[model samples]
Target chain A: MHRNPSRPLSPHLTIWKWGPHMLVSILHRVTGVGVGIAGAAALVWWLLAASEGATAYATFLEWATWEWALLIWIPLSWGLIQHTLSGLRHMVMDIGAGYELSTNKTWANITVVASVLLTVLLWLYIFYGRG
Target chain B: MSMEIPLGRVRGLGAAGEGAEHWWQERLTSIAAFLLLVWLAVSLLRLPGLDHRTVASWLADPFAAVPMLLFVGVAFWHLKLGLQVVVEDYVHDDGSKLFWILLINFASILGAAFALFAVLKIAFAGSAE
Candidate 1:
């Protein structure tokens, strides 16, 4: 009810010193938006193509298996992993467990590293194990 | 003198009473997405091939189809909530913020519907053509 027109807008990103926490926060948003658009589109396409019949499915496979598609798929997978991990970290914080500065930084770093590792492991499994 | 009535002040006890529900839903959906994604990753990894018949048959299983639908729905809902926060935070103009939020909601619904429809079609019609 009390509107303060002069209230400073939050999270002036430029003014704040960069840290692991900031990186994680920014990437969380970036990957979130990225996956929401590109990832969701890919998912819908895959489902629709699969349901449509063989020809559509074959066409989708062609695109999905293309060398160029890996470029998108890899990053998309990474984004998915990173965003999920970060979301978990956020949930933990929401439960009031990780407010300590050191704990927060540690989790942020862990999220980044683990996402990359998991993404690589996924690709490795797809290429080698599946074959 | 302050013009607000005592009842009005007590009615809304905190900053936007709606925040807790939004916050809780985001967390709940995130947890659901976390589990569903693990299932998805492992399932996709184990798939012998990506051919239409193979993938369709895999999706045709009740275990796969049900969870896939749930994943699509929860993931899109979670996505919409997350993006809404981003838009609310960054987009300065009220008109643009509202537009982006509505667009996000609509797009998420469409995406989820398309996904569920596709899954249901495969589940019921059987991928054979």
Candidate 2:
């Protein structure tokens, strides 16, 4: 891990022009934290409530289904969808393919578009199809 | 060719030799989570309802209980792996990074254990209707 003071520096995010790949990379981390905290906490809360008997379960549904809760729920669902899709892109890169600039950008854009689209579809099913 | 000195080359490791195993486990858990999450979504969609009685009884079934356990376990495992990397990237101080990594591991275990307990309680006891 020794470093020479005069050695050339490696390229970094600040040096490169931003692209979808960068966007997706940053988003992968952001959405990962978002989902890991908010989504998992919510799921844990739901399960705990469910196990706490009928009244507790009803209380959870009341709060969770409230319109205001969409503030947390919408972003959470989007985060989960986005993270899942972007993680797939990471998997592709982990295998060492998709490094070509055009190929990388294409997959990155596709991951973004598909995640948003899938999140909408998921909500639609929840609201309408389930009703 | 790697620019390692002969002895270092023979040893075949970078400064942190533990990385490859971490990388592999992360991917393995990610794959498991992907499959399990999909199965969970589809099964939930097919459920009769999400009411207490309905969902509880569904969970009580072995078919539903087993996969639920696996899904919860793998999701938390993947979360721990990913969270550790995030901590390493941001927390530069050795002490803080160690603290955060330990916190991440503990939180993941607690989350998964809480979830497993809830699922098991329903599987064994909550089916009383």
Candidate 3:
């Protein structure tokens, strides 16, 4: 596979001076892909639990309680949070809210901060509060 | 009343109304998704090492089953819309962009449909022999 030297490469994330809208936009794509993978994993677990009988079900159980599940869920929760918040931002833009640069930055900050806060709260509920 | 503007003069490659359509559907879906996520988080946390029967029973509830399906469908559709824009923005080739946009929508639809069908069948199916 010969690399095409003539074709210009896209700008790298690190090189760009990040703005709020740009940051949120990048995070949205990242989280969307992450959530898609998580969705697939959930689907697999669901199908296995449904069709396979008690033994396979127990296998899922083992995985669900392990640290691995926490590892997965924390990021997945954050991903979902980010995706949802960013999605709301897009929806607001569609309706013409936050079209002003000031409002746009405010909402973008809200999206990122809210997603992080939600993720922390989720973890607290799952670990400290529940168990 | 003043004479209406001429169609040709006014139209200017008129909008497909995608803005309103996507905006409305996305908002509706986001609301559905938020509610569903609450249930989902609680339900998953509440699961005490679910045996097959317990898992099946929870999903069998019409309230849970229906919303779960709707959430997945809406979530995927919203995802497709968002990703389509990203792909369109970044992918410079017109043919490639069109191909990807179509592919993304098709894949999400199929995925959402399959998941919905599977869940519904399990939810409503006659008792397993």
Candidate 4:
């Protein structure tokens, strides 16, 4: 790809407002690409499972039980939550909403907060009991 | 006389009308993709080191099957959208831009459908043997 020196420079993170919706859009793309990488890793795991015997698969099973895996899982879950919410925001914008400055900001705030909360609840479900 | 524009030619074009349509569809599918993506991620995490049978069982469940297919479809759509913008912006040559646009669209859709079909066959083929 040819880099265009003359094209307008995109807003730098340092100079940017770092508002909720803006942050959401940035993170959504980041996390979407992140998921794609993680999915590739999972695909490798699948291929390994297919070729290797059950014992090898069990080793992976043991790894899955670790707290460290949970640490990784939390961010992934958060990514999912953030991406899904941001996508919804984009869809709403597609249909025309939150165009007014105030409404846009409010919805953006909603998306950011909801995503984190959802991620937290997901971890709670995984780690703690329903009771 | 310099060719005078007909009323139809002037009025027919909406506000970058077709561009907007493409943009909206991209976004709509992206939303769908994101939801299905979450499902796929969570399901994969759950799988860990499941055997073929257990994995098949999970895939066989309609819950998993439906989302997997949806994820594939939506992912391709989103890819198509993103690539379209890239082609439009970067490839100024009309011939090359058109070629890339068509090529990428074809490849993405085919890849998505093939992936979905492969997963579905493994899930439903009824023979773990």
Candidate 5:
């Protein structure tokens, strides 16, 4: 038994030509796991810290706002946004709408862009509008 | 023409017929989560800051605390359901998939319980802090 020398195997990521809808579809799962798991941990920590004492709350805030923490914080926020938007897109499709190739791709594109834009605007409101 | 046997014609859908329940729960929770999550983002931004007093007093209110608890409960529930599928789809080994699913269930419950406890504590005794 022999396989073709140059043939790509089943379910290989590199074998497929990528599309916007595929990116959004994959992002839906990626964001769901990332935000649901890691973000919940952070939120729970925040809650616990707040429940304990002012000193504990301060400690949590200090790290949460630390410059390096932005790496995790930003992505967590973005993932939450993307997951929400993509879930909405999926909901539309789930209801037996948006299945046409063009409609599906269009909504996928919108989900990607809106998620990013909304995340940015959220931060902007936090930093600038609040001030 | 239907590909239905006599028994199949009598019973509709999957063998267990509960797959749709999982799917329906996911979507139901998603709708709730979407609304609650948006509310959370907006409420957080409304606060002057994330200082202990500001945040604690915010959570101290029934209005704030209730939604947060719902968010925690709904979110963890949704994640458990969603992650179960993820593990099933990806983890080919039966033992491994089962292990992951069990962990997800236990961890989600623990996480939601912890958050709920914290929120409750704040609501009851936040001012004392």
Candidate 6:
């Protein structure tokens, strides 16, 4: 693959014009990494805390609900939703449908918008509906 | 070295027959993870409280415990597959790329194991006596 030393890299990101598809593609990777690293760590912590007892669980709850932690948790939740939606889109594309230019663009837009909307609704339910 | 044929050159390097299997497995796990996450969100919402005992007991239910364990396994597997791609794309160095791939695999396995153990502990230990 690297036989030609002078050939530019396949994905010359800076040279290619950006579009909705590109945005979604990039977000997919970003969110995947985010969930892989921080999200996984958070899950492990939550599990350990839960198993440890009431005191540990309470401590985790307090810290997780704190304002500062919300910064990370909110974005992580959004990323999780966004990645899931985008994954669904890719799954559809994998099956050889939605290849038309307009349809692809439309799906890309839907993936982003729907992800944000769903995330907001989830948080709303958590805060208000649960209470 | 002897000259290689054009078809052989086109075939290129890396694991040849395994790409399709890896791709299918990744997709399968993604689908499973998506459904499991939805179940988790709904379960969390229905919980009477987020306190230790309530959450632990909820997890202890066989219905919840089994799926949660499956979720951890599938989700971490998906994570490894996704991160492997990212590392391969951005990390141009061969050694660094291999290292990152191994690290991602190990981390995913360890993280998933820890989560599974915690859930099982709660399911059997009865949550802090």
Best by DockQ: 6
The DockQ values of the predictions, listed in order, are 0.74, 0.66, 0.26, 0.16, 0.75, 0.81
Off by over 4 Å in 5: A1-16, B1-18
Clashes of each: 0, 0, 0, 0, 0, 0
Judge the docking of candidate 5 as incorrect, acceptable, medium or high: medium
Q: How close is candidate 6 to the true structure, as a TM-score?
A: 0.88
| TM-score of chain A, cand. 2 | 0.87
Estimate the overall C-alpha local distance difference test score of candidate 3: 0.73
- B42-100 in candidate 3: lDDT tens per residue? 78678763567767777777876777777777677767766675676678887887898
lDDT of 1 at A106: 96
Model 2 residue B57 lDDT? 83
Supply fnat for every model shown: 0.88, 0.58, 0.28, 0.09, 0.84, 0.98
List ranges where model 1 is wrong by over 4 Å. A1-16, B1-18
Q: Supply candidate 6's per-residue lDDT for A27.
A: 95
> Model 5: per-residue lDDT, tens digit, B1-129?
887787965453442233667778999999998899989988997788889999999999999999999999999999988888788778888788778989999999999999999999999985665
Candidate 3 is graded, for docking, as: acceptable
lDDT at residue B121 of model 1 (Cα atoms):
94
lDDT of 1 at A85: 91
Off by over 4 Å in 3: A1-16, A63-66, A100-102, B1-24, B45-51, B125-129
- Prediction 4 global C-alpha lDDT: 0.67
In angstroms, give how far residue A43 of model 4 lies from its true place: 6.0
Q: Give me the displacement of residue A36 in model 3, in angstroms.
A: 3.1
First chain of model 4: TM-score?
0.74
Interface RMSD after interface superposition, model 6: 0.7
lDDT of model number 5: 0.88
Task: Report the candidate with higher TM-score, 5 versus 6.
Answer: 6
TM-scores for all candidates: the values are 0.87, 0.88, 0.71, 0.61, 0.88, 0.88
In the range A1-131, model 6's lDDT, one tens digit per residue, is 54787876777756877889989999999999998899989999999999888889889999998989979988999999899999999999999998899999999999999989988998898889876
What is the i-RMS of every prediction?
0.8, 0.9, 2.9, 4.6, 0.6, 0.7
lDDT of each: 0.88, 0.86, 0.73, 0.67, 0.88, 0.87
Which is the better candidate, 1 or 2, if ranked by TM-score?
Answer: 2
